[model samples]
Target: MSNKIPYVNILQSAICIPVSDEVPIALDIKILPDKNIPAESFFGVWLLDVSGSMGGDRLENAKESLIEQIGILPDGTIFNLITFESKVNEIIKDVKITNKSRQEIIKKIQGITERGTTSLYTALEKSLEILRKYSRTNGSLAIRKIILISDGEPTDVHVRSGEENDPNYQKYFMLAKEALEYKSSIDTVGALGEHNVYLMYEIAKLSTGKYIFAENEEELKTKMIIATEQTARIAFSSPTLAVTSITGDIELEDAAQYKPTVIRMPFEKINKRESKAYLRSFEAGDTYQILVKGKIFIDKNNIQTETNVKVLELDFDFGKDGLRETKEIFITFSSDSSKFKLNQDINRKYANVFSQAEEIADCTIRGDAAATQKIQGDETKKID
Candidate 1:
C-alpha cells in the first residue's frame, strides 16, 4: 500500500436548504498529513510577564506551567524565553530542545521571579524581532509561534503616557502586522481577570491566533499547554479560502468559523463575483467548519422546479507546495417541502455565532470589559 496521504480533505454538508433569495452553507475542512511526512521545525517564543502584579501564586503557577511545557516539546524544537517587567530579560536564547538542554531550560524557567511594572509592548517588540531574524534564516517552512502570558496592561511610562493615537500605543498594531508578514502567529493568554482582555484579543485576532482567558491558576497552566500543543501540531500554514459565485447573482453576506475555535472570520470582496477569507494554520487531524451565508437574487419566472443549482466554488490555497484545491457546492431546489430540509447542525451553528456576536457588541457598547471577555471565552469553550 502507498504510504502517501493527501494534505487536506474538504467536505461540505450534505443536506440542502430551502431555495430562497438568500441561502446559507457550511464547509467542513480537515487537514491530515501523512505520518511518514517529516515534521516541520517548530519555533516558539514565550513572552512572560513578571511584573509586580504577577506575584505569589500567579508567578509560581506560570513558572510551573512553563517548566511542564518545556518537557513536552518535541526534540529539535527551537525555544526562546523572555520575561518582562519594567525591563525585558532573555533567560533563554534561540536554543533547540534536546534531552540535555531541556533540563537547563527548565532550571532557567524555575528561576523566573516577579518585580517592577509591566512593559507589555516592549516585550512583544523584542519577541517579534527575534522571530523575524530566525524566520529569515530558517526559511518559510518553519512553524513560528509566540505565546504571550500577561496579567495586566502595559504600565511602562511611555505606553501609559501615550494615547491610542500616540506612536507608542500604535506600535503594538505594527508589531502584529509584522508578525503576520513573518508567518508567525501570536497566541495570547490573559493570565488573570485583571488583564487587558481587549488588547490581548486584538493582538491575537490580528495575527490569526487564538486568545484564551485563564481565570485561575489551574486554567493558566492548562490553557498554555493547549496553546503550545496546537502550535506544535501545525501541518498547513496560512491557508486562504476564495469563494466565487458560480450561478445567478450571488453575493456573500457573512462568514464565521465554528470548530477548532469559535470566532468571526473577516473576508475581503475581490470583485462582484468573488470574496476571500484568511483561515488559520491547520493542525494535523484538525477539522474546521465554516458557516457561510450568501444572498442569491433569483428570478422566480425563470426558476427551475427540480434541479441542483451550483452556487459557489471554494478554492482553498494551502500555502505549501503550490497546492490549490477546489470544490463546488450545490443546493437542490424542489417543489416538495420534504426534500428541502435544512442541516440542523449548520443552522444551530449559525444561530449561536450571530447570537454571541450580538451579545459581545452589547457588552462593548456598555463598556463592560469583563462581560465581553466572559462572553468570548464562554462561547469559544462551548463550541470547542
Candidate 2:
C-alpha cells in the first residue's frame, strides 16, 4: 500500500436553498492541503545582513535566534550560511550539517558581526548559485530555500554619488526570478530598520516563498522559527484542481497561485445579473441545488525518498472549518422568490459573507487589520 496521503484537500461552503426557480446554483470553491509531508533533505541557505545598521543588540538577537533554529534541525540536513556587509561572504557552502561540523557552524555564526553596507542583491545571487549546483548534483531530493534576514535597504557600496546602474532595483527581482528556474525559493524576514518593505515582500512573492515582518527582537525570534519550520515542510509537488463538473453558468473569476500549480480556492468571480435571473426565475414552493465538481491531482512518483530516514509524520485537519478532503458546494434554490430573493437582501448578504471571509484571510496573511475583530472571533470559535 502506498504511504502517501492525498496531496491537496478541498474546503468549501455548502449553500442551502429554501426555494429557487432553478434546480442548481453557482458556488465558490477553495483548495486547501489536508496534510503536508516534510522533505527528506532540506537545503537551507541563510542570507544575513551584517551591516553597520545591524550592529549591537539587533545583530546579537538575530544571531541568537539563528542559533536556536540550528539547534532544532534534524540530522542530515544540508545548509549554507551567507552574511553581507558591503560584499557577500559565504561562511559555508552546501554542507550536510552533522554533529561533527555543528560546532564549526556555530563558530562561523558567532564570528559574523556588523561591518559594512547592505548588499542584498549580491548575497541573493550567491545563494541562488549554491541552490543550482546542489539541484544538479544531488538531484531533486531536497527542499532548497534561502532565508534572508535584513534590517536595511539595498546599498551600492561602490556607488559613491549617483545611482549605480548595474545591480540596482532590477537586480533584486532578477535574482528572485533566477531562483524559480531551479525550483529554489527565498523567504525574507524583515526586521526593524530602514529598508524597502515592498522590496522584501516582492522578493518572497516572486520566489513563491514567504515574507514575515518583525516589530521587535522577540517577534523576530518567533517569525524566524515560523519561517524555518514552514521551509522544512515544502511539499514534494504542487497539486492542481481539475474541475469535474459545473451545474450553472458561474464564472471562475480570478485565481492566484500559491505554489507551483497550486491555486488557492474560492477565487473571486463577478456573477452577471443574467446568470442570477435565470436561477431566480424558478417557481415558488420548489427547492433546487447545484453541484460543482473537481478533484486534486498529486504526482506520487516524483516524490523523492532518502535512505534510512523515516518520513516526518504530520496530521490532517478534517473539521468543518479545518482542512477538508473534498468539497461539495450545495447551491440551494427555493420556489419562494421573496424568501430567497436573488437580487435582494438574501443573495446580497450571502455574497457579502463570503467576500468578507476571503478578505479576512488575505489580511491575516499580510498581517494587516481588516475586520480584525471578526477574524479573532472566528478563530476563537474554532479553538473552542
Candidate 3:
C-alpha cells in the first residue's frame, strides 16, 4: 500500500462572478491522516540578501529578525542561512542547532558587514542544490524553502560581462520552478522596495509561498517575523486536501456580462430527491463557495500529498444534478493582479493552521538532527 494522497481542486458552476463590494472567505478542510507529526520535523533555508542595499537598519534588522527566528524552530527542524552579495555566502551551512549553536549563528550574523551587490541567482541555485541533494539522500518527504531577501533589482550586482548569460535570472527561476513542480514552496522578502514588490510576488506565487514587502526597516522586521511565525502557527493540511483550484478570477460585469445563473450536474445514478441539494443559489451582490471543501492532491507514486488550500468562488449556481460529473478544473494560473491580494488574505485567515504545514515542509528538508541554537533578538522583533 503506497502512502500518498492525491486530490483535485475543482471550481464548479461559474468561471467568474461580479460583486459590488468585497467579501471575506474562510477555509474549512476535512481529511483522514494515518498518524500525528510534530512541527520541528522539517527543514528550512533562509536566503538573506546582504547587498549594499541591505546596509544600515535593513541589514541589522534582517539579522536581528533571523536570530530571533532560530530560537523558534522545533526540535528536529534544520536551518541553512544563505546570504547573498557579490557572491552567495553559506553563513551557516546546514547547521543542526542547539541553544549553544544558536548563539554561534547569531555571532556570525553580527560579523556580516552588509557590502557588495545582490547576486540572487547564485544564492537561489545553491539553495535549491542543497535542497535537492538533501531530498535525494534523505529519501523522506521534505519541504525546502528558497527564501530570497532583496530590496532591489539585479542591476546592482552587475553580472560579469561573460558570466551574465551563464547564470541568468532564468536559472534561479528554473530552480524555483522545480520547487513548484515538486510541490515545495519558496517565500521571498524584499525590504524597503515598494517598487520591487511585483518581482517578489512572482517568486512567491510560482512556488506556493508568500511574499512580504516592507517600505521601511520597521515594516521589514514585522513582515519577516510574520512570515516565519506563520510557519509555526498554521496546521490546515492534515485530515483533508488543500489546493488552490482557481488562480485568476474576474467580475461578471467585467467578464462578458455572462451571469451563468446555473449549470447542470451529471451523475450515473441521478436521484430526484438529491437534486435540490445540487442547485446553486445566487444573489446580485452575494458571494458563494462554488466548491466547498474540495479535495485536491499530487500523487508522488503512492505517497499522495495534499497541498493545504481552499478553492472558493464569488458566484453560486442553482441547477439540476442531471449533468453532474467530477470536473478537473483546467486553468493555468496566469499572473493575475488580484491573485497576490487573495493569497495574502487566504494566508492570514489560515495563519494558525500554516504552523502545521511548516512542520510538514520541515520534515522534507535534509540534514542530520542536532540541537538548535537559541538567539533572542532585541525585544523589538515582535509581530504586533
Candidate 4:
C-alpha cells in the first residue's frame, strides 16, 4: 500500500440550540496538517534604539543580544541593521547571511553607542523602506520582518518644540497607519526603560506581529531568539478564510468584516492558528459559504498561489436550495427532546471548557501566577 499526505483536515464538533424560528449553532474548528515546510528565504530588519535612556548596561546587553541573534540565524537569510536616535542610521543593508557578513554585522553592532533622543517613527519608516526595496531584488521569495527593539517612546525635543499641531503627537498613529499598508511583519521588543508598554503592545498587535516585553537583558536575548525562530518557522503567510454567502441572523464571531467574509488571518502568527465565525438561524435548514484562500511561496523559482472556495450550490432529491454543507461544518436540526438534551449537554460541557481556557489565557497574559493556579485547578477538576 502507498502512503498519502493531506494538506489539511477538519475535525469538527458542534452543538445546537433550538428556538421558535431559527437554530443557533456553535462549532469547534481545529485545522490540522500532518506536516509543514518552512520558508527558506527570510529578510529581517533590526531597528535598534540607541537613545540616551538606553545607556550603560541596557545598551550593552541590547548590543550583545543583537550579536547573538545574528550569529544564530541560519545561512542564506538576508538582514539589515539600523540604529535610531535623534535620527535614523542604517549600519548595514540587505546582505545574505554568511560567515563574513555575520562577522561584519557583529563588529558594527558592538560599535553602536547610546546618545540622542528616540526617533521611533523615522526608524520604523526607514526599515520598511529597506525591506520593500530589497524584497523584489534578485527575484527573491522570502518572508520579510522588522524586529524593533526600543527602550522608550518616540521623543524628539525638536519635533515637540515645533509649531502647534506638531507631528510628534501623531507619530505613533502615522507609523501604525503606514505599517498596516506594507505586507512585512513587525515584531516589537520593548526593553526595560521609560516607555509605553501599551503603545508597544498595540503596534505589535495591529501589525499582526509578536510583542515581547523584556524585563531584563537575559529575557531580551531569549525573546529575540524566540522572535527569530518563530519567523523562520512560519508555515503559512497571508492565510485567509473567505465567507461567500450567509442566510438569516447568522453572525460571524471573529470575522474582521462580513459580506464576503474576510477572515482576519495576520501574516505573523500563522502556524496551526485557528479562525472562527458563528452562525444563528431561525429556521431548520439554512446555509453559509466560506472560501479558503492563500498563497504558498515555495521558492524564488516557483511560487504557487491557490484560492479554494467551498462549493455552495447543491442539488438534492427536491431541487437546488442555494444551501450546502461547509467543508468544515454540517448542521442537523431536530425537535426530539432526547437529542436536544444530548446536544445541550455537549454545548454546556464545551462552553465550560472554553470559559476555563479563556480564563487561563487571560491569567497567563497578565502573568498572574496565583490566579492561573486556581483556574488551572478548576480545569483539572473539570477534566477529571
Model number with the top TM-score = 1
Candidate 3 C-alpha lDDT tens digits along 5-26: 2122322322222221232333
* Candidate 1 residue runs with Cα over 4 Å from true position: 1-41, 157-171, 247-254, 296-310, 331-348, 360-383
RMSD of 4: 13.3
Candidate with the greatest lDDT versus the true structure = 1
Q: List, residue by residue over 1-384, the lDDT tens digit for candidate 2.
A: 012333433333323334222322233332223343433447789999989988888788888888877776667778799999898998887667688777878888888888999988788888888888877786544356788998787785222212323345566777886776666667778776344555665576566565566667776676787667655544332222323223333333223322121112332222321111100001111121222222222222422222111111112222113332333333333334454423233334335544544654454334342233233221111111
Predicted candidate 4 versus true structure: per-residue lDDT over 136-216, tens digit per residue: 464253356788988775774323321324555455545654544445557778775345544554455455554566767
Give candidate 4 misplaced runs (Cα > 4 Å).
Answer: 1-23, 32-39, 135-139, 156-181, 246-250, 255-326, 341-384
State the lDDT at 379 in candidate 1.
23
lDDT tens per residue, model 1, 100-177: 999999988888889999988889999998998887786533578888999887876344321334456456867886
TM-score, every prediction: 0.78, 0.60, 0.53, 0.64
Q: Which stretches of candidate 3 lie over 4 Å from their true place?
A: 1-11, 14-38, 139-141, 155-169, 234-384
User: What lDDT would candidate 4 get against the real structure?
Assistant: 0.51
Single out the weakest 10-residue window by summed lDDT for candidate 3: 368-377
**Candidate with the larger lDDT of 3 and 4:** 4
lDDT of each: 0.72, 0.52, 0.46, 0.51
Q: How many residue pairs clash in each candidate?
A: 0, 14, 44, 5
Indicate whether candidate 1 or candidate 3 has the larger lDDT. 1
